[model samples]
Target: MKSHLIKDVGAKLMNRGHRAILAISGGRLLSAPFGMPTVELHTVGRKSGLPRSCYLTSPVHDGERIVLVASKGGDDRHPDWYRNLQATPDAEIVIEGVTRRVTARTATPAEKAELWPRIVASYRGYADYQKRTERDVPVVICENR
Candidate 1:
């Protein structure tokens, strides 16, 4: 399937009925299906100046912060949500039915060096994704705003 199509459908499914399904299924529905927390990220479109959101899996969530990968399935281009966050760092993230305000920023080289191993350990696919593209995949850290 096309990436954008998958993204749009995923956002729609999560927004429309996935939450209810997750609740009814006792947290085993889609929660951490990928060994990571699923997060609904809310941001403002940089150009449109309108609300934009997408469901993403966070590879690391250590209570104080959540980590997102801008891998875009190794498509060689940054995801729209990633770009949005670049333009406007302020955002909201919904995890386990709780919403929190956050500020998003790309990890520094030092931070990435420290976090990359843990991130890859959480999901090996991310490492493969990184190898598939020339551009470096950005690791985004979101902390309470």
Candidate 2:
């Protein structure tokens, strides 16, 4: 949980590796052996104004809507995708093999308090990730755009 080179490097390696696989497999093998569903978040870069995407697990979704945790594996800083979404809420999400346009927003404090437990219940790692950081990790909700 503490700041350590191994954890930092491992996280980067895992993300990069997972991203590569997703690109190669065309979303068929997202997140590999993890049974939980993973989705591709497409956000316009805040700085470059270019399309960027990263994979994330959806701990909660209701057919038309999905919730993505900006936990950054509980790191102190927000993930780039989350930051980009803040600058440009217009985005896209690829669930399974279907891609759809979406508008994203960080959940309100009241909503975070309401959804936290349900998310943690779906994936225990999210709770552990929070313990590793000082900041309240953001929760992003992406609905049909």
Candidate 3:
């Protein structure tokens, strides 16, 4: 599948449904599915300055640190949430019914080189997503404050 099609499915369907379920279940559902953790990331809009929330699966999680990929289903443009983190690295994430403050940063190329295989091992779709796009997908590390 192409990047745009995947993006559309996420932006238009799955994400919305997932967020609704998570909210309705009070952070109990839609988290750590099949042992892979998912967090609700809260970011400020880069342009609007409004708050935005995105649900993302973390391929790597240790203690209070999590790694997120700004793949947007391999879309050409980075997801708005990732751009928001770029403009404002300070953010919050909801994990397992708790909200924690965090700081975000893109991993360096060397870091990505070491991390990529581990990440793809955790979730194979990311590797497929990379194959679908020409841009280098960003790997963002969000650390607890």
TM-score versus the correct structure, for each prediction: 0.83, 0.84, 0.87
The Cα error of candidate 3 at residue 77, in Å, is 1.3
Measured by C-alpha RMSD in angstroms, how accurate is candidate 3? 2.8
TM-score sort, best first:
3, 2, 1
Tens-digit lDDT string for candidate 1 (43-70): 9999999999877889888778999999
Model 3 lDDT, residue 60, Cα: 88
List per-prediction Cα lDDT, in the order shown: 0.88, 0.85, 0.86
**Best candidate per lDDT, number?**
1
lDDT of 1: 0.88
- Model 2 clashing residue pairs (backbone): none
- Candidate that beats the other on lDDT, 2 or 3, i.e. the better one: 3
Q: Which candidate's TM-score is highest?
A: 3
Q: Model 1 residue 60 lDDT? A: 87
What does candidate 3's lDDT look like per residue over 10-76, in tens digits?
6958889988887798767867764678888999999998988878888987886889999887777
RMSD to true structure for each model, in Å: 3.1, 3.0, 2.8
The predicted structure with the larger TM-score, 2 or 3, is 3
Model 2 C-alpha lDDT per residue in residues 2-88, reported as the tens digit of each score:
555676677778878888887798766665334567787888999999998777789888777889999988778888888999999
